[model samples]
Target: MLAAIRSIIFIPVFYGGSTPIIILAFLVALFSESGTHFMGRLWSRYHYLCARLILGIRVKIEGEIRNEPLLYVFKHESMFETIDLLRIFKKPVVIAKKELLVIPLWGWIAKRHGLLGIDRDGGGAAMRQIIKQARKAVAQGRPIIIFAEGSRAHHGQRPELQTGFAGIYKLMELPLVPVALDSGLVAPRDTFVQKSGVITYAVQDEIEPGLGRDDIRDRVHAAINALND
Candidate 1:
């Protein structure tokens, strides 16, 4: 009953105010990202707060966030992980699908804040773009985060990872930081009832980028599976 009411009020308020709120926030983040690279950090923190306050989601960190630029590979369970990581990490360069850039204020903000959007279906073109953007972000000293599975996992299943990450790994040559999360399907797909629970994030040791493509993928997958054990 409480969750339902929260959804009722939050849904209308979110839809009604999303455009203006995102626009204002985008502008603020633009200046912040440009001036100090702290806007994304600030926006993420407040964004998480709003998610919790408006929808009743809770998050808990279980390990220390690494302090260097590396490829952050994590389980893709839900949108919550995306937002939550942004809030926790400092200037994390995210790799997302290009379609997200088509959204109004949100897309603009993502592009301006240095988020890398890939054309997942672009074949070689997409790989090239990812490598380009990723190298630039790494050069700027920001960790590159990739949802190794490529897309969100279903209620009881995990998605197969695309080989694109392998290409990025080989090209850029950076260490890999394996991250895992316990629960993110609390709200489920296409639903608004945020089941209240604690989300756990575990950051593992960094894997050097010199491993073979298959080896790298296997190692990252092992880390994620280890979290489930």
Candidate 2:
């Protein structure tokens, strides 16, 4: 019942309170992409505060965040870490669903802010296209970020890395840094009944570029699931 009460208050507080900030972000995008990123970071910071104050959720980081440009791979366990990584990694050019690029205002701004959207149905051709886009992002001095599994999974779900991970890693020629997080423990998918808990982000060491596909995949898979282990 107490959990229910917290979720009830938090559901509205998290969404309603964030609406204004998002609206402000749309306006900020009209002027400067950098200003838009500042707003995005602000938006993420606001949620962190809300998650802590209203839902009793805390975030713990287990490793260092680098400042250099490279490939950042993350575990996608819930929606919490999706945008939260913005503040965590400062500002990375995220590889997200192509559909996100169609979401009215947010999509347009996201593209301008350097989001690389991928169409999941384009098969090998899609992977090639994403690699092409990633190259441009790298040239612009931005690190490429992606969710290893491509989509969220239930708590304890250890799905293998998506097919594109290997293609991009090999072609991008950027060191791979895997980040693991346990957000589903508290901010689970498809529900608002959040519990008080620590959502831990485990950043593993960097794997050098040019590793073989099988070798890199195994290393990244293990690293990103470190928190689960």
TM-score of each: 0.86, 0.93
Q: Where in model 1 is the C-alpha error above 4 Å?
A: 13-18, 28-32, 35-39
Instruction: Please write out the lDDT profile of model 2 over residues 75-174, one tens digit for every residue.
Output: 9978888878777866678998899999877788788777888988889888888888878878877778999798898878899888878888988999
Report, for all candidates in order, the number of backbone clashes: 0, 0
Q: Provide the lDDT at 203 for model 1.
A: 79
TM-score of 1: 0.86
- Pairs that collide, model 1: none
Cα error, candidate 2, residue 195 (Å): 1.1
Each prediction's Cα RMSD? 2.5, 1.5
For candidate 2, list the clashing residue pairs, or say none.
none
Q: Kindly report which residue stretches of model 2 are placed more than 4 angstroms away from their true locations once superposed.
A: none
Please give, for residues 97-180, the per-residue lDDT of candidate 1 as tens digits. 888889877887887777788887899977887788778887888888888788777445655567787887788788887887
lDDT of 1 at 7: 69
Tell me model 2's lDDT, rounded to 2 decimals. Answer: 0.85
